[model samples]
Target: MTNAKTLGQAFDVLLQPDKFRDYGPNGLQVEGDREVKLLVSGVTASRALIEAAIEAQADAIFVHHGLFWRGQDGRIVGWMRERLRLLLTHGIHLFAYHLPLDAHPELGNNAQLGRLLGWQADGRFGDQDLGFLGVSTQPWSRPQALADHVSAVLSRPVTCVGDMGQQVRRVAWCTGGAQGYFEAAIAQGVDAFITGEISEPQAHLARETGVAFLACGHHATERYGAPAVAARVAQDLGLQHRFIDIDNPA
Candidate 1:
């Protein structure tokens, strides 16, 4: 059995949560078993995921999105109460990593996305260096071609805005609900900007800016980090790890 504290400490060192200012707490949200034998990883710490973890006989649940956001209601009630009740009832530890997971060079969402697309990461830009600056291996001459490539890579429908015929090679990306970073992407002068979610204003901005904007699903883009980190944790801690992916359209 792997000690939860040992695993959590190692994970913190791996991610360096102190380096980034995150929206929510980074690690060990709900403490469960001190000895974590069966650890499960997922994108979010939702009720569905918790139930899956319970069914899998997981001692701990590691995730990207955990309980309690910056502005969310602190009181344990409604859905939040239900989620916590299930975890507490089952003695399942809940560990979450947010911005740190996104910023990690190897296991991060941006880096994984880049690897999947075979794009070379030149550098980091935007808020807290969360935005990835990269280029496709071969320049996609048409915007539609790039969109098609993204859809193929992520295996999900993408919302693309801007001229489909425009040539794009230089690209910048920030995964999951980063539509606000479009201006920052524009400043980088990238040929395209890719993110998880998009707002209505961004559609107009994409039209006006001439830079292609691709809204891949928020869940699709961020599904890599948690499992990657969790796997590493399992390896380091000598614990059995399983990744439970609950379907998320968004």
Candidate 2:
């Protein structure tokens, strides 16, 4: 069985939180079990997810989204209180890597998406709080082809707008809730953009922007980074690890 100190140390090295200035505390949000063996990895630290970690008997819950943002209320109440109560009651560790997971050069969400879609390594495009834009190696085949590739890889359903067969040479992607960047991608002359969630205005924005848009499920798209990070940590630290993906259809 792993102790809390060793687990925390391994996560610090694995996540490298100093590199990305995140909105919330990026590492060890709620400390519980030290020597972690079973790890529950997911997109967010919702109440249900916390319960899942408990049900799985996990020592650590690793996720992309964790509690305690920069400006949010620090009080424990409502949903926050319930989440904390669950963790504390179970002695389950909560570890989150926010911007660090998104911006990591290799293991990040953007990086993995680019690699899966065969995009070449290019630097970031822009920022909203903190984000990056990636480039495609070869020009896009068609919007539908790209969308099909994304849906297959992410294993989540998708919603697409704009011409399916439009020629796509450039792509702008921000993993979760990045519809606001529709205009940003347009300004950059990107032919297509992908994000986790979409709003009603986003459909019109895609039409106005004349860019192919894909709304891949937020949970589906972000699941890779946590498990990849987990595997890396296990390999490097020689610790037993498992990434539990609690399904969220959204």
Alpha-carbon lDDT, every model: 0.90, 0.78
TM per prediction? 0.97, 0.86
lDDT tens digits, residue span 93-159, model 1: 9999999999999998888888888889998998899999988898999777888888998899999
Candidate 1 clash pair list: none
Tens digits of lDDT, candidate 2, 176-248: 8778777777787777888888898888877766788899987776877887777787676666666767788
Residue runs of model 1 more than 4 Å from their true location after superposition:
none
TM-score of 2: 0.86
RMSD of each predicted structure? 1.0, 2.6
